[model samples]
Target: MKHLLFLYLGVVSSFASDTRPLKERVNEFCQKHRSIAEIEKRHAEWIKQEPDNPDAYILPANALAKAAETVNIVAGDQKDAIAVLTDPKTGKQVGSIAEGPDPAIIKRAEDILKAATKKFPQRLDIHVGRMAMSQRIKDTEAVTTAALDLLATAAKDPQTLRWIDNEQIDGVPLKKALEEVEARIRWLYSFEKDETDKFAQDCALKALELAPGNVELLNFAAIRHLYRGEWKEGREYLLRAEIAAPRDWIVQHNIARASAELGDKADALKRLQAVIKAVPGTDDAKAAEASIKSLGLDVPK
Candidate 1:
């Protein structure tokens, strides 16, 4: 019996570790505008491989839900719609006998949180996840209301404080207070001094803890790192942000600068060539092409 129990535990542990890279790869693919078919395949594989992971189910559902925008409204084909999810890749249909929305991801992230809350009633992340979704929808009333509810609940549990305060992935404890989030916003208001940039920098870092792999947050962090001449850290995050938001010209240049800083001339030239090739006729593109020329590169025609 002891050996059997140990084997079971080992299997569970290995399964959990394996899922980490799968999630990261999904996030990376999303950033790079990978095809729905690809993400869908991987997502489908994840649910199959780790059927018990509620979060894995949620990831694919959320991805399709947002892009497909399956809202509270249902179509006349409701029975069939719920019967099988329309495959985002091949435009085919897949039916899972699980019943309900083919990928009843979450009608809203709140649903996921509610489920999470039941399991971890004490977990502040469950509350924050819901609140974060509320903010995404620009539901100010909802954000304020839900945040208040969480603030009250977290007050009774010091463990929840880091969730809002500290800047860590998988979420912070309730780290600081709602006041801190607000204060960061307030600081964004017409303060002409350099201090605004500092607060934005601080808030950007804080945002990453809550929403890891966020391109906007990564860009902000990269800018701060650039200002401080922290080339290595700045370059790594910029590369990630580049994958996330390729159209951002600033990110393109940052990649070049990072490569130059690292003395990787080949990589620097190649990226610069890509940027210039992406927009050949523009004055800005021309200037970038010149920068590549300065690198002694043979510009790709």
Candidate 2:
């Protein structure tokens, strides 16, 4: 998904200038599935060739983000499983957990993004790169800061509405792209600070006002209410989400959770079972199973 976002960024950049040659090079590099080392080397050369160009920084930053994501996938999978290392001399076996990506790589990516943002403060792609890198590293503070920066930029850009009306990004409507940014802002605020609840709610409300039928934003609003222990309000929003997206497993899962939290065990179990039946072998189904077990109800086989 992040890779696709980077490609979309490339496409968007193409619209800004007649840099077809450079864009082609980037697309070629990405399509060839070059090693991170090769990508770093080529992107460094590009940066040296065009130190003032934002694309120089953006390309390498994206490559670095991809590298970070790849490493994280390996590390996360390893962390979920056990690995045993055997000593040659004493034949001793020791179990160890997998390590995360090298901090130096992440730092390098961040430095490139920071430098890009500093040089081209108005460029939305630079901030998006920063946000993606921050998320890869699980840096909540950095993510929130980047998200806020993105929101501020989008809000102030007069061309945003025009872009939404006419542009398409990776086959997604520009309006949906704007909604995605707004949704991310809401998500970031949810984790930012307790005092940011109002900010989160306001952002969600504003996003819904702009794109009222956005199920994800509606679900976010519902979760925010649930976070505040307002089950009735949460359920109301969830129902709205359901109306907007009836087959969305996440909405049903949240409804089940809300019901369980409200002491409606029978309803909770029924909703969870429905979710399981509707979306078997999915994350939501697994969550529903767990919720049922938490309620001391047997999952229907």
Candidate 3:
């Protein structure tokens, strides 16, 4: 009877082990650790055990990102404290602390992501992870390069582009990744003081290449050109956006603005009226009304 009980227990143990998923086990292990070093060690073990698993790479990247966030929080507090201090003698600014994430942590995360990229060249998420970590560290070149890599990868796979456009693929949401890349391009457009608009324009164009006919990206590209006073280029993008989203009043409004800037008052007035007609009682309509007034045209009744 004792021998029979032992055999039953062994069978139950084997059955339970077989039913547990590897990803669940890894997640459970990671959740129990607070230390980045411990998480990294466990993730390394996972990679060793399952070299082909993308999660093995993703888990360590996440752990490193958490570490970087912790460092940034501490640094931000230091910077905030510095901002309130002033010189006692002159009541003027003395010195301010410039703080950011630890360089060592950033470097480690970059190295891991680089390895993951080489190992899983087609994994868009890994490139996204790299882009995010680079943004955290304010590495503009790295962020742009990663964004470009993501665009290139998406271009190679129609399904990937579709996933990004539709916001998810295989249960992973692409919205955040797309937003991050777009935000980086917008930032470059607004704050890249030393560089010409070409770099930001190029990044935006590359993104459009991957997600052609994307209205938001098209609008973004249009705005970048308008901001740089390239009215002709801006008008071209606006026309494309109008084609992509014919009933979108905001696109019509932008088309009006671009036309007005290019000294085409009649075209501008016509588009503003169309915008007001298509989306009455909305903010776009209000803006269209204002533009019509600014263009010395009568508001449509």
Candidate 4:
């Protein structure tokens, strides 16, 4: 999944001068993939090659945002990012955008975004990143405002409405792309507070409805159940997800979590231990350790 994400992000650089695809790909990667390093390297080279271009910031920052996941910390270069897109004097970033649970990254991203927005006030990605960052910092009003703004914009551009005639709707075109964007954004907020609401469930459901038997939707639905503390249901969903996404660490992590919550601590611990052994310094491993500690389970360190 991570590799495919990096690949998709390669296609979204808006090397074409548009924020829509780049914004969508970055958000999708953050929520679903485990690493963005490949794309980050690509973006770094892109920036190095085009030092004076404002457009470079969008993909480069997004690349960093994705790479942040791999390091178990927000390991992105926001200053390099904003310096490209930001107007400096006003302190808002435009075009470039990202999401984070890490404060340092969020602050850096927001500062840059503030600079960029001055130059491109109507760019939705800047507002989305700001709102997501504000929520992480616990600025309630800002979160609410961002959500309201996003919802307002989203209302006008429903997945149903973003389609255009003669735009090649089949084999990955406008309609499918728009739906994926909306679904990812909806669940990102739903899962951010470590809880899954009905709205998030709806998004997952819609995804499944769109592509029945899709392992991706199955995995997302499983996580939603996990977030809501529905252990048994979460486990059942995850069992299917694990089958569908055998190599995905995120799914593996959720399986461990649900197993622990359901009192299958031995299985959970084993899975956690195996993942950490396989991928050192991963958030999946950290989360597994946290779960083990919380459950009074012991594992060899």
- Segments of candidate 1 deviating more than 4 angstroms: 1-196, 293-301
lDDT of 4 at 272: 78
Error of 4 at 297 (Å): 2.0
- Please provide, for model 1 over 1-301, each residue's C-alpha lDDT reduced to its tens digit, 9 standing for 90 to 100: 0010111011111123334433453354356434456546766676577755444433443444344333333322444243545669987654432222222322343454444444444444445555554434344444444454554555566453322112122434544443344433343423433455455565556555655566766877676667677889889888888777888777888888778778888788877777778887887587777777676655557
Regions of model 4 farther than 4 Å from truth: 1-165, 169-188, 191-196
Q: Residue by residue across 1-301, what tens digits does model 4's lDDT show?
A: 1221222222211233443554465565355433444544554675577643334444444444444432231233443232234547885644343433455544554544444334333344444555544544555444444444444444443342212111223444323543444544354655466533444555555545555556666766666677678988978877787776776777777788788888898898888777778777878777767767877778766
Q: lDDT by residue for model 3 over 191-229, one digit each (tens)?
A: 645352455666778888766788878887777677777
Give me the displacement of residue 195 in model 2, in angstroms. 12
Which prediction has more favorable TM-score, 3 or 4? 3
Query: Which candidate, 1 or 3, would have the higher lDDT against the true structure?
Result: 3
Q: Flag regions of model 3 displaced more than 4 Å.
A: 1-56, 69-100, 160-180, 183-200, 295-301
Q: What is the lDDT of residue 273 in candidate 1?
A: 71
TM-score of each: 0.36, 0.53, 0.68, 0.42
User: After TM-score superposition, what is the CA distance of residue 232 in candidate 4 from its true location, in Å?
Assistant: 0.5
Give the least accurate 10-residue stretch of model 4, judged by summed lDDT. 160-169
C-alpha lDDT values of all predictions: 0.52, 0.62, 0.62, 0.52
Model 1: residue 127 alpha-carbon error in angstroms: 18
